[model samples]
Target chain A: MTENEINHIFQTWLKQHKALLFKIVRSYAFNEEDRDDLFQEIAIQVWRSVTSFKQQSAVTTWLYRVALNTAIKWTAKERKHQDRHESIDVSQHIIESHQPPDDRLAWLYEEIAQLNEVDRSLTLLLLDGFSYKEMSKILGISESNVGVKINRIKKHLTTKSEKS
Target chain B: MEFKEMKKIWDTQNDEALYVINEDALHRRIKAKKMGTKSRTSFSEVLLIASNLCAGGVVIISHLLKNSGNVAALTMGAMMMFVGVYILFLRWQRIKRDQQTDVSILGDLENAIENINYRIKLSQSMIWFCLIVIALTMFTVLNSDQSVFNIVLISAFFIVGFIMSRWEHKRFNLGKKKQLLDLKEKLINEFEM
Candidate 1:
């Protein structure tokens, strides 16, 4: 595709999926700066991949795949770096957000944050209403495995919710 | 709760609360991207200018020495050696600066790759400059009767320099490939874990 066409497509995708990108970054990043960095990285990656986007999948699916992949990688690097030092103070920005909290949703997010990178992705996909098959395609996992993992994750979340 | 109930809550939640991405913010990002591109292009231009100046200076010096006769042979040889050493020093400094700036994993990899490609080109030009200076100095110092031996020696030196240059090119490519692969593996492991 031409540069202009790619830019148009990216602009449209960005406008439509801005909230999805924000949520993914918020879920995966440790702080506001990290979230913004991940967001830009995802945007650049998406722009790079725009030419190769065959119509085989929906644009939303492609966006989720790219965003989740970038977030996962970034979070892994941050975790490795964090091991050597005190973690950056991400909680301050989280507290300063003006949105009123939903206790249950906040609890759910806290639980999700505890998951390993891959499990976190699966849970996010499940929460977003993607089917096991769709999750497998996005994640490059077997459909059966997606089902099994989702079941395990849901049970784990249920136990955590009950305790809370 | 059932999956459907969770979906209902998720769907109803206000996405606008998550982010307020408007045209103004996107416009700012676009401006940043353009500025970044401009900076990179200008940096490459600077490198191109330096490389041309180095090559041009060497060629002019070589021509002047060749036209000045046998007495000028020693002076030309000394000048060529000095120029070669100076070029090598400049090349070393450039490589050191590039290494320091390009080591971070946070920056865009494609930009890094492009910068490395430019450096490789510069290195190739430097190698050619060295070879040309050495050859011209040899030609100036040797008598007309020694033409056959000088040709043989110059040919051998040229071959050796060419081989070394090719090896350096390969090393450059291998380093870039390894970096890109490491990046890919890191990303895949993070998402596939």
Candidate 2:
């Protein structure tokens, strides 16, 4: 497709499914700056790959795959220097359960933040209601692994909720 | 948490402030294409300098040899030509490598660090090569009977060039490492949060 047509399709998709993108970014980025950076990166990657998008899978599936992979690589690289700084500030940003505003969502994110990288991604996809097969494709893990990881994450969340 | 509960929370969440993609800014970016243009200019400048230096060296050496019938000037010209060819070939290879991959913005940032590291390595090698060649030429020209003053001058030049090149190499590596670390940290924070 022409660049304009590709861009038009992307804009429409973005308008429709922006929340999913934002949700992934919000789960992965530390702050607004990082989120914006990832968003731009994701947009650029989507644009680059649009030419090769053969419609073998749903567009949403392709988007999630790109988003998750980009976010994972980005986070892995960022962890090298900011570990000390991140640990100190993480608690402050932890979502407080009783708050009525964004804090509640922050709480959920805080909980997500506590998960290991792989589990965190699996949980995010699961929360988005992707089936195990789709999650496997996006994550490059086996379907059984997705099932196993999701079950464990669910149990862990339940335990955390009970204590809360 | 259940999907229903999560969806409810998601629904209630406030809309994030919309990011205004300034058309003018994007237009400027398209026009400027700073990195692409800068890289192109740098490659071109290096090529021009190398070509001119090599050609000038050869012409001067030939003229000097023709005037004085000295083989030493001819040898210096040949050496300069070799270095120039090497530099040209290196630059061409680098440009080719850069063209092989297409990356997004973040990938570009990531690749920028790698490119910096690559440049550092190249600079370090070039510096060492230049130093070695300069030293060899001075030693061959001066021989054991060479004046102390000439030897000292040559030594000084080599030492200064060596020092500057080493400093640049270290600085480039340090900057690249810091950038990679920052990118790593940002990614981790996002994932953890």
Candidate 3:
């Protein structure tokens, strides 16, 4: 795609689906500074992802893959640099201005943040209504494997929710 | 509060106007990000390669300008050129491999592991390069009329440089590689069972 075409698609995707992208960022990063750094990285990836947009999968799926992969790498890189102190761009929240208004949603994210990186991704996909087949495809695992993990996640979350 | 209820809460974000996109600010951010994400190693490698080629060129030209070419100088200069070309080729291959897009997260993770392995290999090659160059120069110095103190000082300097390079390798590459490997194992275990 041409540069103008890519720019247009990026803006359009951001306008339509910033919430989706922001969910991955929030799920992956915890610290305020780290969140901003990750947001910038994800936004950049989304912009660049425009060129490689094959129509085989939905745009949202492609975006999720790109954002989650970036988040994983960023998380690994950030953990390695424990003493990092670079200033971040926080002029505007870009995607969303305020925190989730609902206490329950906030609580859910906390529980998600407790899980390992891969399961955190599975939680997002499962919560967002992706099918087992889609999850398997996105994760490069078997549908049976996805089924098993989903059951486990649901069971674990239900037990935790009851305790809470 | 259950998983189903959590899904309902999450789906609310679908209609939530919690996001506001400022086109100009986003344009600026994207532009900035485009420039910033190139790996620092890539930049340093380019500088090191240039320095090697230039250093090699200077040594070759200076030695050749004399009545007779110094065999040791010619060998050292050619080795530098060879090392530079070797690094360039490795970097080019790596960049090419990195450009291949894999839509699956597992595939991407695998690619990341491979990239880190390549970095570790590159770092090891550099250490080897330093050792070889030092040995070549040391052999030349020993053959010539060099005093014992001067030889000891040069050997000490080379030893210090070697020690520092190993320290950097441990500090930067090995730890990160282990973390990624652990993450991969965790991910695999989560679903494989």
Candidate 4:
């Protein structure tokens, strides 16, 4: 497709499924500004790769791949930025504007946030109803490995939630 | 609750689970992004290019002075320009690496680790060459009987640059490389777990 046509398609899909992007961003970023930065970063990435979106998988799958990868790299870079003394105190900037109204969902996301980065990605994908095959595709792991990891993550979460 | 029940709750979570996205702001961001890519330069690249310009200016000034021993000054300035260009090229490669998306988390982490490795290697490897250039430039300036003010300024630059480079190597390069490696190991270990 032409560049404009591809961008148009991407923007349309982005508008329709923005909540998917939101979930990924929220899982990764700690605050509202960070969330906005991550969302823009993901959007820019999607636009850059839109022309290469050969439709090999669903558009949502392609976006999930982009969003997760961007968030992973972005978080790494933010750590580097902090080390360089160039980062803001994101803790102080937490405005509480984006908190969920539901207590369980909030607690659930808190648990997800406590996960290691790789597990966090796995859990987010699992919660979004991705199949083992799909999660494996996005994570570059075997489907069996995806199943094992998800089981472990579920057990961990169950233990944590039970204690709380 | 069972995993299935939790999945149902997750699926049925309210829109409040997500932050409100402003469509107009998003559109504006997209437009700005399109404009920003034309002649795209990262922040690091801008700093590098600015230093290159300063080096280029030194080269022109030294060449125009036309002293008998100005050859060394000209040569050092030229070397600075070359190093600047080379570093900019490397920075461009790194910027491309940073832009890589649509990959798996393993791929992303691996790329991040590699990016840091490249930076550490570049800084570690360039120290001697930089010292040589600075020393030669100072030598030429002193040998040409330049003003004491200029001589002191060049000495200050040499001292600061050398110390900063050494400090960076000692303080950041080793620690940052180790940290990135540890992070990479943690990522791999998590996947295996």
Best by DockQ: 3
Clashing pairs in 4: none
> How close to the true structure is residue A20 of candidate 2, measured as C-alpha lDDT?
70
Q: What lDDT tens digits, residue by residue, belong to model 1 across residues B4-98?
A: 55555555444536455444544555445544434442354355456545655665576576674454444444554555566566556655655
Model 3 spans with C-alpha error above 4 angstroms: A1-10, A30-34, A47-55, A73-83, A87-96, A158-164, B1-6, B19-37, B138-164
Using alpha carbons, what is the TM-score of model 4? Answer: 0.69
Give one digit per residue, the lDDT tens place, for model 3 in B12-99.
8888764455556556666765666566568757966897899888878887887345798789999898878877887898888877
- Candidate 2 overall Cα lDDT vs. reference? 0.62
- Model 1 CA deviation exceeding 4 Å by range: A79-99, B1-4, B14-16, B33-193
Q: Which stretches of candidate 2 lie over 4 Å from their true place?
A: A1-17, A33-104, A116-118, A129-147, B3-124, B136-165, B171-193
Please, what are the lDDT tens digits per residue for candidate 2 over residues B69-177?
A: 4455555556667767766776777667666533322344455566666676667667766765676567565855778888888789778967876785676456656
What value does the lDDT take at residue B113 in candidate 3? Answer: 81
Judging by TM-score against the true structure, name the best candidate.
3
Give the per-residue lDDT of model 2 (tens digit) for A61-135. Answer: 878777776676667655443323321222222111232437667777888888765567777777777899877
User: Model 3 TM-score?
Assistant: 0.80
- Reference-based TM-score of each model: 0.55, 0.53, 0.80, 0.69
**DockQ in order:** 0.14, 0.11, 0.58, 0.37
**Candidate 3 at residue A70, lDDT?**
80
For all candidates, the clash counts are: 0, 12, 0, 0
Ranking by TM-score: 3, 4, 1, 2
The docking category that best describes candidate 1 is: incorrect
Write down the lDDT of every candidate, Cα atoms only.
0.62, 0.62, 0.79, 0.72
| lDDT for position B68 in model 4 | 42
Better of 1 and 4 by TM-score: 4
Determine which window of 10 residues in candidate 1 chain B has minimal summed lDDT.
B101-110
Fnat for the candidates in order = 0.10, 0.07, 0.72, 0.40
